[model samples]
Target: MKAGRKVWSVLMLTLIIAVIAAGCGGGNGKNTGGNAQPGNSAGTTKTSTKDNKDVVIAVNANFITLDPHNASDTNSISGARTMYEGLLGFDENMGLSPALATEYKISDDGLTYTFTLREGVKFHDGTDFNSEAVAINIARIQDEKNNLRLRKSFAKVAKVETPDAKTVVFTLTEPYNAFLNKVAMAGMISPKALEEKGENIVKEPVGTGAFKFKEWVQGDRLVVVKNEEYWQVGVPKVDSVTFRPVPENGSRIAMLKTSEADFIYPMPTEQVSEVEGVEGIKINKVDSTIVRYVTLNTTKKPYDDLKVRQAINYAINKEAYIKVVKSGLGKKLDSTMSSKTQHYSQQNGYDFDLEKAKSLLAEAGYPNGFEAEIWGENDSETIKGMQFISQQLAQVGIKVEVKSMEGGTLSDMINSAKTPEEAKIQMWYVSWSPSSGDADGATRGLFSSEMWPPAGANTAYYKNENVDKWIAEANKSIDPKVAKDIYANIQKTIWEDAPWAFMGVDQIVSGSRDYLNGVKVYPDGSINIRQAEVK
Candidate 1:
């Protein structure tokens, strides 16, 4: 046993040294490490195509799906957000801003939200933007048979009606103050186009946004043409945009440096100096809504016991891990919901103490640590997090067998685990991306037991009557201030229970050429190319 521990310790030390060494050495210079310098105004990359009249931007990966209701992956949503129109949008600061809806009003009771559609708005197909299209889009998303994956917020939507040609009404079952924030995800689509294409409609999306869907080649590239009829009028200066999937850091950085690709979606940390020192390239960072954390399978042995879960969390040196993994770019998060959200409570922060963790394990009847599998996707961020957890947990007698799998396989492992017994895979690294900047938006779904099993994202199987009631009541709160208070309480309760060991808030980074200006870098990494023009 002593020899085993020594071997594991050496292995972990070696891995940590390797990661630090590789990070410092500039791995492939792809900007994956989140260390790139911000906005270099000098020099310019020659456009590969001889079209200086229009703008062309490049990203990693073609969109997986364009259908607003069905879009899942960030890549697809990023493309759709550009090609389609939402009632509202997040600006460069990621604050709520208007998009399709020119002006909107809430009822005195706050249950009804009425939106006045923008005039002269035309879909890519030239269909008039009106309330009918908005109504249909909402109806389709709420359809249970269709199994809309992104309908977490829309579950509260009772009905969507068009009272007038230009007026759209959203009637909620309860007064959900986050309704407008939710609308940011529910992009407006054309009713006529949906009728014409059916399921195939995703292939050709029509919206009033500044960009129009052109073509998508899976695993390779997706292209979009600028909307000449964009209702935003004078905006959308870019002529075209292309998203290419370059998983390899070396290749992505090579493309960015050589001017083959105008911009890379995420600038890795390892290549910070290369991109920053490069004359024409620029890097911008924003505090994203996404938070990385380890979701505990509370239903399974060891983790099923709150004491054990707390021990696992207490044993983690999150502050040190953040420095090592994020190179000090990431912020420590203790709440299940993001700190960027309005209702985040600082009272939930967890501190590291290996002695406390060991005592908790002993109190939970495991004087010596138990062995369990730590499952996570084979990504730089995920691996780094798991490594930290594995090393820290070892100090408290927990033996973690690290199993790295492909993203799809890891997701399947977590989703397919039906019961806590079947689902307990020691530690799993997961990301939480909230559409609405509210804790209720992300926490309610994660803490509620009803939303779990083979369906919802609550793979943790964490259930609490008090937490559930708080979430339910918060969902019904019509006033924003009231709802925020309720959610703050909910975060406190969850933190005390230690359902998850929150890691860090990732920095949303973007890279572009010197000529690209007015490129709005959203806090959640969603940017509006409407105002971006190539000089």
Candidate 2:
């Protein structure tokens, strides 16, 4: 027993050493890392192709799925983006931009959206992209039989019409202010592939983009080759782009240093100084919408009590968490979404007060720390964050056992629960970005009662009559000011409810070879390789 204990301690200490050696920008809509240097201008990657060299990018997590209609994680969405072009897209700062759709218009009532499909666009499968393709993609998402993640968001669609080869119109059941944003989130998949591949399309993706999916060796690499017959001329500067999933921080950084990987993201925060002045390498730090937090399952005991939830928030030291866990590359999370997100409003956050946390715990009938488990992805930085939470909670009479699982495993564990009562999760240390670039994207899926477990990401099982109503009211509201006001109310109420221990906002820190250009990280943390080049 003693020997086993020593071995376990040694392994943990080694992991801490490797993990604490991290540094960078986190994803955000507002500021980059508080004190981290902005290595270069955010979107200065060269757009023109100079060479047909293959580019390699190393990321910290494996992609979950490539099917855009069902992609739930950022990495998976990014992987899908390599081969898929949405009707609309986001600019660097997350402003809506035209992609497959050349022009779009919204009705005054916000119930109808009409788009002019880009002319001469062809899918990797050689099928023409037109209004019919758009209708097919929307139908796939709207069909409940498909069980797509995008189904709920598109449920408002009452009808999709293809009046001509180039025009697509959508009529919603009611006014939805975010219809345009949701359209941007909908990536265009080949109608041919959809009809033939069916459910297999998740693994075998066919789309109309600058790149075409070559192969995906799960957990190893997802490779996309340049489309020789791409519609947009003089684009896709590289011959091929290979995304390698190197989860270990040390391994990923080493690949960048040894020139094995042309680029790496989440440039280990603690190791940023080590690579800042290195030759032949460039770092890009961008303000993003990524925010980290720990979800406390409100359906469970202790966490069910508002006082207990508030105590956990008070117990965490936000500033120290940024410095220690994030290696000073992040800002304390002030709201559920980063200030960069649209309709963001700040609120008074629970400051670190160990005494107050203890007092609250005592009032909740636990004078001594209660034993609980904290869950996180099995990554160096995530484990460190979980450890930091564990230590902070211990000071306030909360004894937490940290459990780290792979991203897919952790996701399955949380989502496998058929109901709230079946969920075994106590706390989950995770990060989220409003990839859709809307406050509704940030708030609704996470806090709405209609979204729970397999349905959506409301892991807290947080349900409030007013919050639910405000979400609906906000969605139906066409006026930005009215939506802002309703969102503010929702934020304030949830802030008081304390369903999560708001951690910090991340600045996306990434490193690229000087020769590798045009790959940029969006404010939502999804990597854009539409114009990747080996200059």
Candidate 3:
């Protein structure tokens, strides 16, 4: 196991100009319709009946894509995990574990990785899972023409060799300490399916996981059925899983209470108290590596000025945000990466000070703050956070118009931008979890200039030559001390640059029926249901 086991953890516009001009305010600050208290049975665990064999999970948003190699969002990653299996995977503790690959070893020089893949594994489409299958997946991601979202993670991969059916070897151009973690994150796809679907792979994902794709209704729900021939025996106890996108917090709570949903993610911190005493319902909370922040489009005016970015950061009260927006259930974010993330180093904290913010604004040549718009998903909590941001920035003379739209629409708007100049975004209230369980996962996608939109998650258009250099160095460093130092420098420099308004760290709160067993939420907010069972 020592092979690589060293490290462990939008917008929409329109209906007329009037609606756009009039900012959309936050919803009434109260849980209303979903307030029906659970019955006495809520407090006790119920035995799973035959009808309960199929589990229903309600999420805050829809999945963006099922293609594991191209997924960047948490919801999408969770969905892809249901059907895809990587050579390596993270254990419950977020440590590296063998998945499709039974064993692996790294060369002393750290330039070569040899893997022993598990035998008899088969893709959902019945394709044999062997060394060739692993090679095909790696080649797909490493292919420059594909422009896969996770291509950079495999950038150092120089060559791949499959000596036999059950063995695959990867040769790196240079030492990469994070390569194992990246492999774990890059789930394998069926070569046959890739050939058949090609670009449509995102819609038709085929893999060797516990569950096989059943159906996907965009914007509404995604359903997956258990794989009877799953490589791992006696697992995937549930017959099926249906993930419904319920953006409304109250509606999700209601579904949980009524047993319409066996589980729901993001138990909406504001309503945690409401379900605390409910019978037959359990609320699970864990510290997460997720960080909520506002990506300030650095290429845009006002935000283009470093002083303005810093001023915005100083203006907002992060503690108040945790209290009001998160209902005091989260931690104020101090750095670009969450403290739970690997190689995380606390940077100089930005305390709320209106005077300093105003002064900085004045120095940035805007004594009177300018007008701008902030965009976020239509989720209740997201809009509330954006509203709070709008109000806080207003105090610093920055007039903000808040616009919340469906998640898919917002994604289209952001990703469609071909360049920084074409990006219409000014500020985007968003959250990110480096589910890959590495410092590079947390930093590279958001900070590295090479990861700009359409290619990676760097939506802010933030660029820094020094930070980029350090990011690459940190990933390639085999020495922990060197990597840690480089990461610390990266965080410190980004913190000072203020490309983002660090908001808070998430408390991964999920609610499930007491009878739902073995379903655990990881620190990255992705749920593990491979061993989940009812009763």
- Which candidate's lDDT is highest? 3
RMSD of each: 5.0, 7.7, 8.4
Q: How do the residues 467-515 of candidate 3 rate in per-residue lDDT, one tens digit apiece?
A: 9889878877989999999999999999999999989998889999888
Tens digit per residue, CA lDDT, model 1, 475-501: 778666877788878878888887787
Candidates' TM-scores? 0.86, 0.91, 0.91
Deviating ranges (above 4 Å) for candidate 1 = 1-15, 18-64, 403-413, 416-426, 453-455
Ranked candidates, highest TM-score first? 3, 2, 1
Model 2 whole-model lDDT (C-alpha atoms): 0.84
lDDT of 2 by residue, 25-86 (tens): 23221211111123332333232222448888888788888999888789998999888888
- lDDT sort, best first: 3, 2, 1
Per-residue error (Å), model 2, residue 153: 1.0
Model 3: lowest-lDDT 10 consecutive positions: 8-17
- Deviating ranges (above 4 Å) for candidate 3: 1-50
**Cα RMSD, model 1:** 5.0
lDDT for predicted candidate 1 compared with the true structure: 0.71
